[model samples]
Target: MKLTIERAALLKSLAHVQSVVERRTTIPILSNVKLEGRSGRLSLNATDMDLDIAETVPADISQPGATTAPAHTFYDIVRKLPEGSQVEIEFKPDDGQMTLRSGRSKFSLSCLPVEDFPVLSGGEFPFSFTLTSSELKALIDRTRFAISTEETRYYLNGIYLHAATGSDGAMLRAVATDGHRLARAEVTMPEGASGMPGIIIPRKTVAEVRKLIDETDGEITVSLSETKLKFAFADAELTSKLIDGTFPDYERVIPTDNDKVLDVDCKSFAQAVDRVSAISTEKSRAIKLSIERGTATLSASSPESGSAVEEIEATYDSTPLEIGFNSRYLLDILSQVEGETARFAMADAASPTVVREVADSSAIYVLMPMRV
Candidate 1:
């Protein structure tokens, strides 16, 4: 394969595909990226057996052929080249080496047979839909922080994507939880997305797709089946294997009868929690919230570091209540609130507390109280 591509264009495509290659792999071919230069374009493909990314870019092709080469080394060579340089790539089958030339610098990367690379074929994605970049970003950002990192509950290690009918109309929802906290976000259900199977997209795949969304403002095409999911955005395509376990019924945990409401300025509440938590122990990270009719106080105490307390104005008319919550968890949920005020609905200090932005009903957060 012989092709000439701009250093900027080649580096951008390489950055996307090379991240899928593992730093250490037992199989030799898994360490290399499959490169195909044909039809005035160069296609770069890389996979770690479970997830795969393929990207294509315009290139000046002198010879049409395909080969495999080290993904990281090839990317590094092009990245260090001079700006605005034209990179010429050539592969000779007899020598089993791929050569890169730019300016006065030259690099030779060892090549492997293209046939040895594994292809993650997404067979027949019957359920397909499109989502704007902004919509997709909101869904991922609101829920991904609550995704479980525990290995035993493999099903909870990803976001649950499914279609549901609310009081307003049909909606597409993304829910994630780690037993201590839960986050749910939804958008207007797109046409052709009804009756789609509920799928648990792994954490790594969610992160990769989110990164791609930042590069374009155009609509993203999503295709999925029972076992696989594919995201096509910009000039790149990503395919990943879905988790093969059942997610728990999250509705059972969300409380609907919490009538006591407390509304506080998000910025002030978050700042107070951060200051008080400084005195709390590292392991517990616990902070106490004391809410009255029109005032709320946040306090934290540690045996070694003493105690701290701060009062913030709030709007609450219910019976006075005191609750203990993990300071870190509280701050994480607060960051998701886009509005100026955060509303918390609580039944008691022992029950789960529901939180949401005052102006946005599209997202909800639930936090479990802890002993102070």
Candidate 2:
């Protein structure tokens, strides 16, 4: 394949596609990106068996052909090339080596047969819908942090997305939990999403799609089946296989009838927890919250590191309550609140605490209390 493309455009597409290629792979072609040049455009594809990313960019085609080259190496070479320089890529059919020429620099890299690269079959999609870029970003950013890293409970490793009925009727919800904490976020459901199956999108795919959505304001076309999910946005597309397992019933864990309500500034509360937790033990990053009539005091003590105490003004009419929570969990939930104030609803020190953005109750977070 021979093509001339601008460095900036080439690098942008390369950056997206190459990130899907694994740094180490048992299969030779899996570590390389398939480059296809035909007509007036160049397509780059890379996959790690479970997930695949394909990107197409306009180019001046001199010879129509295709080949597979080392993903990271080719990306690095083009990234380090002089800015704004036109890149000429030529593949010698006889020797199977791809030559890259940009200004004064030239390099010959080994290539693999394009036929060896794996392409995920666009399986039969039973359901499809479109979502705004910003909405998808909000769902991922709010819940991804709660996905479990534990390999044993593989089902909890990705955000659980499906259709649900809320106070506003049917809505698209994304829920994630790691046993200790849970995040549930949703947006107005599109017409066709009512019968969509609940799918657990792997953590890696969520992160990749997040990056793609942030780069553009275009709508994302999502297609899903029983086993796989696909996201198409702008010039790029990502397809990933769903985790084959049943997600736990998350609703049962969310505490209801929590009578105590504490409203405090989200930023100040997070900072206070962070400051107090500094002296907490490494094993248990616990910060105790003692709430009374109109104030909340945060304290942390370690056998070896002494103790810390900080108070933040709050509005609480319920009886005094003392609860301990992991500092990291508190910070994670606080970061998701868009409003200046956070509302914490608690039943007792032993029960899970419900957290919501003071200005919006549509999104809720649940945190399990810990022993101080």
Clashing pairs for model 2 are: none
- lDDT (tens digit, per residue) of candidate 2 on 209-315: 99899798979999999999999988888999999999999999998899999999999888888899999999889989999999999999998999999999999
In terms of lDDT, the poorest run of 10 residues in model 2 is 114-123
Candidate 1 C-alpha error for residue 151, in Å: 0.8
The clash numbers for all candidates, in the given order, read 0, 0
Give stretches of model 2 more than 4 Å off: none
Q: Candidate 1: where are CA atoms >4 Å away?
A: none
Candidate 1 per-residue lDDT, tens place, 44-87, comes to: 99999889999999999999999999999888888899999999
Q: Rate the local accuracy (lDDT) of all candidates.
A: 0.94, 0.94
Q: Which ten residues in a row have the lowest lDDT in candidate 1?
A: 114-123
Q: Roughly what TM-score does model 2 have, to 2 decimal places?
A: 0.98
